[model samples]
Target: MNALVWYVIMKWMPKGSSCVDFVTQRSLYEVRKRPSKSYSWVAFMLANICAELPWNTLMSVFIFFGWYYPIGLYHNAEPTGAVTERGALLFLLIWSFVMFTSTFTHMIIASVDVAENGGNIATLQFSLTILFCGVLVSPSKLPGFWIFMYRVSPFTYLVDAMLSVSLANALAFCSSVEVSVFDPPSGQTCGQYLSACTSIAGGSLSDVNATSQCEFCAIMDTNAFLSQVNSYYDHRWRNFGLMWAYVAFNVCAALFPYWFGRVPKSAKKN
Candidate 1:
């Protein structure tokens, strides 16, 4: 089916330049440096790519999918769950793979910047690919993708960001790799609320089942405490891979220091 569609597009496109060639040429021409600073609009991406690998990966994934599915929204009460599920999967898989590819592009530039042949984007890309492989590739909600970003988290987003930055740092050291801090926010969680139970039965709201209520309340409190501590270490102990995962994160983050594409060729230098 895809082949057939491509065949039709190629057949219908104006001759002298086939569909493939047309796109290839256009990409090449557009990417070529110019006086207008046309690529500046995409400068955010280019600059971040040169700086932060994981972050760039996170942001790029959100942007690409957000464009592809502009209405990728999460309802307060997502009906049927199917809508949210589809949106999340699309966001995760598509975004991760696309961004996974971007890591290579970044590494190439990183090595060039540092004048090192071994320090290519491949490792950075690999780390991200592995990091997000199961999480995104597997069926999951988009909100779940960013549980780390949720304000409801016991800690503030700043703390979470610091935790991640730190974890990324640790990864760089253990793996003996240079990690770059380049990712910026690409998607948002929209709105969220965090309300603790202020009263028991009938004080402010309707009476509830004590057994169930206490059980849940206790659970929430425990999770809240652990998540807060996790904020300190970025939940490193959650998995054994953390030993090296943090190592990998720290590796790519070297370029950042501050803790913060597609195919096609180029036309020519302006």
Candidate 2:
């Protein structure tokens, strides 16, 4: 669903249609380009990586503006009330589902196949990833097992959680997001913009009275976000259950196949 939507938009993109779009198109020339079960992975990774660049950037931009992307979309309009941003909630849910589905499917099947087939695992992974770069590429894959991702949400979640772990790992490098004194605002602070937090949305907040920097503010916001996400575990057992399930499944997914398939075979050969 997400792949189809993304590719459709890309088709109309002023730049050009992406390989994902081309691959998904109902045509022989395009399908011939796929040539393997791994074709789906090629499409998946491309869409996944591309999806992040925009979504993450947008979320960060929203924060840079005054309207903190609400962790939850609850709203209050009349006489102290609360309502959810239905659209935002829907978007997040769908996006999460789509991105997770593609990435998890590709990484698992391709990694397994490469290791089993005596292929350069690194090259196999890289090539599949690059195929996501709108390039024609593929990974080694078993027929039925590899395509199993075509419609498996549970397996998708495991793959999705592992991918999320990988992403959080990469982003973990930036222990903090600092807006230093020298870091100029991405906009001007003249007249209407003066003392206001200028953002892409034309929203701004007056600088904290006599505040030296907004980096601290940024940090607080981030801490708040982490706290909020962590708080979800406390707010509902279902959330806690989901996180544990995701984590457990990811561990088992990565470990079971590799540990059982790799070590035992080598040990037996010994």
Candidate 3:
């Protein structure tokens, strides 16, 4: 994708020209080259999407069957049985987001490279991208300024969408039993009233009394777990739409540098 952007910029723009001059010339040239430019742009976008689709699909399948299904990660209190569909959709959305964002970023970086006379900043960009994308820290934990970056980062949406699809309806079951007290003053015992004990939501230990001895039932429902981690599931599909919108924005943004920052071969001699 980066190479493609570089090629497009080099081929279309005049050399040894300032970004402002390149924009002016490109606009004039567009009148005659509009059709070709349009075709190339569409072709590039389609190629990017196509190239990534199959691999992403295969990985999604592997994760669903290998990790989610076998481990019962999608099991819920209601057992809706739509785990496969939801999980597949989630993965597809994530890939779509990744592909578009990558292309957009590459185009921007390519523009920068051209503007800077080909000084490499790929490493810097990669590190910044990762840092801002909520990979190193959860968005909820970030400070105010960084939180803005977290919200804008596509990874945030991806994580939310995945969590929603995978664990939205999941119910955490008690995997073991240990003798414990529910209420000491009431003389209630967990072992004596096993059926009365209910599965607790994740991060809800505050509701339990301090004297309660049921320390073993700390399991959480899927939704509750997500809440505890400050990840939401209510807008999973909405986020998918947002991701597509971001892709469109990237496509549009790529045009600016292509037109304004590109240098033409003729300008190199001057």
Candidate 4:
């Protein structure tokens, strides 16, 4: 599909120019021109951050109050309640950073694809994104080489951070019930100790005993549950820091392509 689109675009492109040349020239022109001194790149970045802040905060509040609050109440869980405020703040920060990084990273990728592959790299890019982002398999289960991809993907950090913020301290109560045979001690007084008590009094053990009580027990605690699923909060802050670092790295990466692609063909020959 991408090939067909590129073919059509190339076939009809302006007589003397290809898509790559056009994109490179346009991008270089934009970079070279001083649009406004008051509106610098730093100012643009700040504006993007500020613009995303309120939306991120609103989403965090909704998740905490609407989703977390009700679920905690339903389960009679109190651990999350204590840290809801802190967790929400962390969630907001991480989400905002991720949004910023993803936006510029995507821009960088698209720009590079246009300049190098005539934008035919979409399918490859999408596949790689999904593969490395833990969408197809969990990071812990990925093979050695693929594990590197998982580790490098920003999606992995986002997922880990979100899970840590939402479910780290949350408690889940799980119960199991079982029926067991009533066996008396070897020397105990059988008549004095009517050990078997059932709904049908004086009924035989083999008979239907609807009155027999089922034993219900708690299976595991919060830590056990988290460990079972390989979820942890110990590295949440670290992940957040890494995500922001990715944002910075992506911004630089996006700009690098523009610089690289802007070199004139004649200059390269000379």
Best by lDDT, which number? 3
TM-score of each: 0.22, 0.24, 0.59, 0.54
- Tell me the number of clashing residue pairs for each predicted model: 24, 3, 7, 1
Please provide, for model 2 over 18-125, each residue's C-alpha lDDT reduced to its tens digit, 9 standing for 90 to 100.
222322342332255335544553354344345644664454344323221242222211112312332333334333433333333333432243323322342344
> Which parts of model 2 have CA positions greater than 4 angstroms off?
1-111, 115-237, 264-270
Q: Which ten residues in a row have the lowest lDDT in candidate 2?
A: 165-174
In the range 1-270, model 4's lDDT, one tens digit per residue, is: 123222322332222123354455445444763243444444443443356447655654654465445544323224545465554545454454435433443344434535445334533443465467554577677888777787677656655655555555554444332223344445543332343543223222232322333222222235444454444677677777777777677666655564466433344664
lDDT of 3 by residue, 138-220 (tens): 66677887777777765566556666666777665444352233454455544333433453222223234354555445555
Tell me the alpha-carbon RMSD of every candidate. 20.2, 20.6, 10.3, 12.1
TM-score of 3: 0.59
Which candidate number would show the highest TM-score if scored against the true structure?
3
Model 4, residue 239: C-alpha shift (Å): 1.4
Error of 2 at 53 (Å): 17
Model 4 TM: 0.54
lDDT of 1 by residue, 52-96 (tens): 446645765655454434432333114434445434443443333
Runs in model 4 deviating more than 4 A are: 1-77, 105-110, 113-130, 133-136, 175-219, 263-270
3 versus 4: better TM-score goes to: 3
Candidates' C-alpha lDDT: 0.32, 0.32, 0.52, 0.48
